[model samples]
Target: MFTPQGPTLRELAVQALSSVERGYDLLAPKFDHTPFRTPDLLLDPVARALRELGPYETGLDLCCGTGAGLGVLREVCAGRAVGVDFSAGMLEVARAGGPAASYVRGDALALPFGPVFDLVVSFGAFGHFVPGQYPDLFGQVRQVLRPGGQFAFPLPAPPRPGSRGYWAMLGFDGVMRVRNAVWRPPFVMYYRPFRLGDVHRELGRAGFDVALRALPELGERPDGSPRCRLVVATRRS
Candidate 1:
């Protein structure tokens, strides 16, 4: 599911074997060319949702790989837009563009910034974190946000059981589990474990007042439920 500009099959294999940081380092150069990059189709609706919640002064993009989410921050924030990630290679690529934005290389679980942001957003990066790590990750995001500030991101409804997409994700995570059991430096990207109900509890435990907004642009399921939602988690004033 990659373009000619993306990494080769062999390249992907090497990445899977390496540590998560190193894998992204090698993949960073061609990340945008791969299906891994956050698509503009999704970003547009997320930006629309943010505009409704904002007129923010400063914004931060958590796990902002390749700076794709930085544009959303620039669109909503009136002041500075910043991106932070642990991957130096990703930050290098992100920094070259987005003149209105600055980049920082830091762990997501332990961010360096103060509560300086009026808004925080992330895209296509949560799968990298393990389920247990959600609390720490969300805590870090809250720490970097001002009181009454928002931490928002989009979440898609899980694929139906027995669906091709469901099987695809299940297979991927199964392989990952096997790899981590047999290999060094586990690459923790799994799709199925990130359920919305679990996340709502985690965000609440992390001290956020959480709510969900339907993104109708992504369309609806047969049951008329939204396929995607904008998770708006606010730090209490």
Candidate 2:
């Protein structure tokens, strides 16, 4: 679901044919118009959660595309805020107009900074990483965080069985699997596989004491579970 100003069918097709980095580069200008950009609906509540957890200094946003999470960091962090991503084009857009933060171009798996941040946040970028890469990604985030620091992000509940969303996600992942099997420089985006149970275990193995906070603003499911939750992973102090 994209806006009138968003990339066209042809543009999206072209992007799908390219590598992830190059595709994002081509889409960066119109990214916010697309549904791909992290929305204020999610970011606002995450900001509130961060505020309750901190008066943190020196925040970082991992894979901070257009810098929405960086804005959240600025709201909660009293000091310097930074956004990091591998895409120079995305970083350029991010630096153009966001809550006055600097941008760093670097891979998420090999984050460049040391244990310098008191808080780290990411938004709408997890699908880019596969299950096997979770350890390295978590490790990189841990490496950049102070012992008592937090790594936080909002995660929506999976679509219910037999729902349109459920089928749509399954179909999309299936398509991606086929594409990667036959294509070069695979896109590597899959929505169905990032389960919360597995994620909690992985974060624990990566030395984070994990916790969950429901975002009431996002409402709840029919079965009374939170529609969305904020995963707050803290490095052991």
lDDT for each candidate structure? 0.91, 0.92
Q: List runs of model 1 lying over 4 Å from the truth.
A: none
Q: TM-scores of all models?
A: 0.98, 0.98
Clashes of each: 0, 0
Total clashing pairs in model 2: 0
Off by over 4 Å in 2: none
Tens-digit per-residue lDDT, 35-121, candidate 2: 888888989999998899998999999998888788788899999999999988898898887669889999999999999999999
- TM-score, model 2 to reference: 0.98
Question: What is the per-residue lDDT of model 1 for residues 85-169, given as tens digits with 9 covering 90 to 100?
Answer: 8899899888876446889899999999999999999998898888999999999989999999999999999999999998999
Top candidate by lDDT: 2
Which pairs of residues have clashing backbones in candidate 2? none
